[model samples]
Target: MLTRISSVDHLEVKQVVFSSVLQLGDSCILNGFSRALAVQRETEIFYGDEGNFPSYRIFKKPLPLPPITESISFLRHNINPIIKVNNIDVTAVSNSSILHVGNSQTVSMEVRVKHIRQLLLEGHEQDI
Candidate 1:
């Protein structure tokens, strides 16, 4: 499993009210990238709710089965998320970028995570 953190700034808005609360949707499918993390296993995504940050719900679903392949399948991809504040769609200026806190404005954050196995043990030649 892998995790990362990134930030963004320099945002412009005319009129937008932020969400005061976050409620998880009953059934919501994660986006392509977030869903990809659930390959063959269920996963939960948590975002924002950091120090003085409002929590946001991404999605709720079971793990998706990855494509069957005889050879080893390598996973390599970066997730670029589009952030939304209080039902306001914030255009992603760049990949994995968030809007900059403007004057007298606030921002909320969110994250997603999925893990299959907790522990795995492999034996090698001359090495247990």
Candidate 2:
């Protein structure tokens, strides 16, 4: 069992128990079972290394869900977060927007089989 405060939404995390949810909270969780798409802004430069690099200005717009693969990464800015979960390792590459929690936030979560194995092995089945 593990716990910590998430900087994303200031939610208390109990653990990383599944692929859908990167972290678990009392009310909701951060999910990563799907690929998140973001809007991009392109620009043209006339000077500097712009000639050597790709001649396009790429700015990934902030998204509701940060783009993450393998581990947690590309979290949007404004969402100051600290992920705390046991046996979970996340790597973030870019920063952009905030993941908001409003009145419409859902509470249901899907637990992963791997998380279940870890909990039972550690004798914390009650947590499930």
Off by over 4 Å in 2: 1-85, 96-128
lDDT of 2: 0.32
Q: Against the true structure, whose TM-score is highest?
A: 1
Residue-wise lDDT of candidate 1 within 84-123, one digit each (tens)? 3343344333222233322212233333444334222344
Error of 2 at 116 (Å): 45
lDDT of 2 by residue, 1-128 (tens): 22334444344434433232332443443333322222222222233432222322222232346554676557455453445333433443122212233221443322211111111334544554
lDDT, model 1, position 23? 22
RMSD of 2: 22.8
Q: Which pairs in model 1 have colliding backbones?
A: 41-63, 46-111, 47-110, 47-111, 48-109, 48-110
Query: lDDT score, residue 106, model 1?
Result: 27
- TM-scores, all models, native as reference: 0.20, 0.16
Q: What is the lDDT of candidate 1?
A: 0.32
89 Cα displacement, candidate 2 (Å): 0.7
Q: Rate the local accuracy (lDDT) of all candidates.
A: 0.32, 0.32
Clashes (N, CA, C under 3 Å) per candidate = 6, 9
